[model samples]
Target: MPVPRRLFRAPSRSLLARLAALIALLVGALLVWTLSTVYEQRKLMHRHQAERELQTIGRLQAQAVADWRTSRLADANALTDDSLFAQAVARWQSAPQTEHEATAFVQERLRILQERARYSVVSFVAPDGTVSMGNSSKTVPDAEKKALAHAIESAAPAIVEPRRAPFFAFPFFSLMAPIFDGTRPLGAVWLVMDVRTSLYPLLSPWPTASETAESVLVQAQGKDALLLTPLRRHGELETPTVVSASDTARPLVQAVAGARGLLYGRDDRNTPVIAVVNAIAESPWLLVSEIEVNEAFGEAATRELWVLSLPVSAAVLIAALLLGGWQWRARLRESALKDKLAQNMQWLESAQKAALVGYYVYERSGDTFTLSPMASELFGLTPEAPVARTQWLAQVHPADRAQVLAGLDEALRERKPLRMQYRLVDGSQERWVDMWGEHDAPSANARMTGTVQDITERQRAEEKLGQYRTALEALVRQDPMTGVANRRALTEALTVEWQRAARIQAPLSVLMIDVDHFKAFNDRYGHLAGDECLRKVAKALARTVARATDLVARYGGEEFAVLLPATGRAEAQAIAEKLRLAVRKLAIVHAASGVATVVTVSIGVATAQTKTAMRSEELGRAGAQANAERESLHLIHQADQALYAAKEGGRDAVVAQAEAPSSTALVGSGAAPDPTVSPPPPRST
Candidate 1:
């Protein structure tokens, strides 16, 4: 078989060549337009990615605080009643705390909390600002305490210690929240967690010059910024010479004030950098990434064009007449690849935008770079800006200049991406942002690429979760109707108190309350009215267990239970007697049990301490047994029988149960003990 000979020959005329040239020119123009469009789209995508990264880092930090609060709420029975903050605050307000007492408390708490957290530092503080318990390597300064006091006195409701912990030797920062007594401010509970741990999850990427990239957390306070470098920004390279910290922070502040994010540049040791400046939630923090742009996009992008142009030129000359066909094929394939990339990039950008993300690229060659939609929006610039480098930095936050410069110098030398968080005073409002990216030494100059994101919602969510958690805990530990400890609640409280009593050798007391003839009262009045009567009875019990360590809970259908820490049987009996009278005074109507015209109650008291050989559970059971042995299931079960002795011997009275063999036995008719008032066996709620 023979290959078909070329069919058409170029017409022997100059006009034919001219016509072909025109078509070639048109194709070339189209190529440029299409390629430029693809590149532009890529820029937008980069911007969005940067922003998303920032938001993620911010959220992670915020969630950490929320988790801490949740852990505190888990022990609802012990934690809610004698809130440490509430107690400490009251003590501090009432009088100067004895240094010995304050120190001992903090030290004890510290030893107990010696358990290290993988991501945070936990500790307790005294009213006089003494560090009682913590293992954090970083030190808290007195100035910080003053600042905390000011913030506590300001707008903060319950939010204390609102900033990230600073890296040791880099910067010192942390926050504290004051405890409260209703509306009164108490001593603060401090939280100390390093910012690096919070940012690592977000700025893990951004390749380096020699595989080196750095990240920094910029703290913007007024015209000053404290740059927290994850690693030395410029390894072996001395910190860059900068005018002042304001130079780095001011531009970002202005950008945020304008509500426009900024993607600009600076020359750190003559190495070009592209920075994406953004605000964190409500904190005074900013996230800035200095990207090594040239190595990242310059050669790669231009090299792609170089390879493509050469092949097309060769094809054009090799088969002049078929040149158009060949070029068209190449152009189409290339366009498709570019289009796919652009589309994927678009998707990434959209996802980020919906997530409040932005991206950027830096040109190490000291020329220009591109930013995505989010980045453009960050700086209030059109996507058509020629050079998004130093020209735009004029609007940076003055407060963050020093911090920003330090971060840049470190990033370039270390050849690593940097992650930073800071607050910017944009116009009148403060905006927060987080950023990260790396350096590229391969581009002849240093550069980096990274992302940023906004996390206002996440910050707010964490704060709200704390308040919600408190409410949930309260629901679990309190009686829904009377705001007293429910039966289950009292049991748990006793368990904890027993352990504490053993440790301190203190006494713990229990009071068992029963409404006399409650069943008859319910039967006479409708169940609805009976509920009200029970509620009134519960209120009486609540008042009896009013101490900080006391627990009052619904014991049963018509009874309530009280656990009083540090109280003996004598004290418990006294309190119980008061409760009995308070209930009798209600004068609730009871048409059923013809014996009495009003509702009354009976109570049993028991006391035990760590010094006792018997377990709290056993002691409680014995008290129940005594009540059962001495009384019937009716109001006078024990009290009624004794009262009957007092009343039939009198009327309306108080009584105690004598010893018995069985658990929770009742004193009723000698006819085998009228089985109704036996105390129920224990079980966990």
Candidate 2:
């Protein structure tokens, strides 16, 4: 039995209608997805742009703060070097009972300094922790008086942490410089500054001018984070607004703990913000620049709204047209299919260019290479140019040519895949390319097909990574504050130099240098000035020992060690004297030093010469090499003993000691030394 023609025709009509509806739905979905993708890309680009802008502003603000602090410190340091002020201070300190004229003159000079430097108050603090002269009668607090004594002892400028003045009851920060009369402490000059007027303004008026954009300076005090500078939205200027350190979302807490870069977190007002945190170099402060997330993304949101509307309107218009022209849908579908095919081909071409990849085929028997247009362009040749194996190899860098050829040859002989990364030079530019090849078994001729991808950016990134690793290694071997070789590096160098000296039968000299009265200097000048003083001393010692073979390293705080290979006791003594004289010539005032008015160093020099031979069985073959290391340690111990003797004999002198034969003999015999061996005498220089 056959079905009726009318039944077949009805089902065909229903199927056609269903197909048209399905097509309409599919087209609308595609349109929506494309619009969403475009909107997301635009939003991401805008967000990245904003983040970059914020980072630039944050760095600039940090630099400004650093410059401001440097300038303020320079002002205080310069005052310490003023001859007129020093002379007035000297006269007043020498005869305070009879020097009424000197006191008046010093007070007048302080007034002039106060006016010139825009200080709130100016005072002269006596060495006995008393405010001897001032424009006002307000007595200095005992805490500040102690700080003054510290500054005078260190003979360096000190910046007191901001606080409320005792009598005036105003928030202020003080800068104090020690008064020195030929390295003898006379008194200190104090300049108190209003923080609101001087430092608070640095945080305002952000670069982008958004309502919520702000930059702030924060300092960590105990378990609390204090807003050292003003806040744009909350808190009083120059007043301590403390927040808990446990709040990990707080940028101040993160920054104080040494976290950096852009972060998404809530501000003090609990508003969502994108913040960039940068630490001010050499200061106990953080510069945080933030803006509300909503405000930052406002323009991107508007653009997204427009993008959404465009696809919806297009969908409605397309739906209407499809329904009205239902009769011509079959023909339209055929034409649309052709257009889609062409578009897909164009998309593939574009994808290849974007990825920097190209295809190629190599015919081994014919010695020919067939390149796609993209591959030809990658090699800087005309598109669709006929390429040969020789021509392709010619484009390869001379340095990479041999390796590439070897890989190709091995792959051909073994019938294996070939993968290589090499450089290709075109004119003055060089590009890195990763080439992969596999045997094409289907081909009648011996052939391989593969892809070549431009990997220049990746190569450059790897090179940069290598350089950063090198820099990181160097930093690990260097002291961050003093810019000298650290103890670890010094230890490694000593080991190498010790072994070399033993092999060559040369003397190895070690100098242990300790800065005189360093604790007193640090107590007086504060840690920042103390660091500066150490940096100066380290640099001076480095310059004093110009020999490339010699190593000057910061052994520890206020202590440095110099390793001199192939040097004897007399020469080491002369070098120690030169170093001592060099430090004295620096004329760095050390008011609390008992040895000299200026900064000085006590050096202990020790020299070791190879003189003893030991039985192989007694030394143990493995311990033979350890003997040199043992001797090096013994040398350092002797130097430290000499250093102690120099310090005992009054600092600012050089002491010398020679390595004892008993120490080496004991090491070879594997016997510990007795506790009752008398040490060598101090050879004063």
Can you give the TM-score per candidate against the true fold? 0.37, 0.52
* lDDT tens per residue, model 1, 1-55: 8766677665653554456556555654554454445455545555454444433
CA lDDT of each prediction against the hidden true structure: 0.50, 0.75
The alpha-carbon lDDT assigned to residue 685 of candidate 1 equals 17
List model 2 lDDT by residue over 359-434, tens digit each.
Answer: 8888887877888767888887655555777788999999999999999989888889999999999789999998
| Deviation in Å, model 2, residue 403 alpha carbon | 1.6
Task: Kindly report which residue stretches of model 1 are placed more than 4 angstroms away from their true locations once superposed.
Answer: 1-355, 360-434, 442-445, 458-470, 593-596, 612-685
Clashing pairs in model 2, backbone N/Cα/C closer than 3 A: 150-524
